[model samples]
Target: MTIVVAYADTPPGHAAVTAAVAESRGGEAVVIVPAVRDERVPDVAELEGRWPELAGRVEVERGDLGDPSDTVIQVSQRLDARLVVLGLRARTPVGKLVFGSTAQRILLDATCPVLAVKPSVAGP
Candidate 1:
């Protein structure tokens, strides 16, 4: 089964990739990162450093797709993915009322199942 991860240079995106990889143990996990237009986004170094840990499980694709949420689902569809995974940031009621969450948008539009991962931590 093919699983797709939507990655941005954000904590949520990082966690999304991690969750994607974990769930894709016996499947293919593809990471989709948008290419910057004029300004560049930092490269995902973890993709290389963690190669040994991922090896055949992960594949990276770069594209300057116009719509991030749409692009993510499109890539998943193109790959015939069984799942599309993305991280979600908890938003306040006001925030959600003003602007919907990416995960919510994706969940509503994705053709396949979508996994919304939220980071849960304790202590400091």
Candidate 2:
């Protein structure tokens, strides 16, 4: 089974990748789909360099879709992924109301299970 990740270049995005790796059962492929509009997709080599566990098993899939949320859903469905992992960042109520949320849409629209994670906070 494949694990699809909604990737961004942020703390939350890194956390999502970490969570996906942890959730993997050794043989499952981890496919990353950029989840932020206009954000560049990370090279597979770069990703493997950062997360050694993902070496040979990680790939980037830039679907032929426009919206980030739509692309995520489309890739997950196309791959029939076992899971979809994504990260969450805190947003003000006003900000959420105004901008809406891609994460929220993916969580609701994905046909498979979705794993949502937040960055680990450092303690004082």
> For model 1, how does the per-residue alpha-carbon lDDT over 37-108 read when each residue is reduced to its tens digit?
232333446574553455555666654467667677777878888888887777899998897565776899
Predicted model with the maximum lDDT = 2
**Model 1 local distance difference test score:** 0.68
Q: Report the lDDT of model 2 for residue 5.
A: 95
TM-score to native of every candidate shown:
0.77, 0.98
Report residue 58 deviation for candidate 1 (angstroms).
2.4
lDDT of 2 by residue, 16-56 (tens): 99999999997799999999988998899999999999999
For model 1, name the residue pairs that clash.
none
Model 2 stretches astray by more than 4 angstroms: none
Top TM-score model? 2
RMSD of 1: 3.1
- Model 2 alpha-carbon miss at residue 32, Å: 0.5
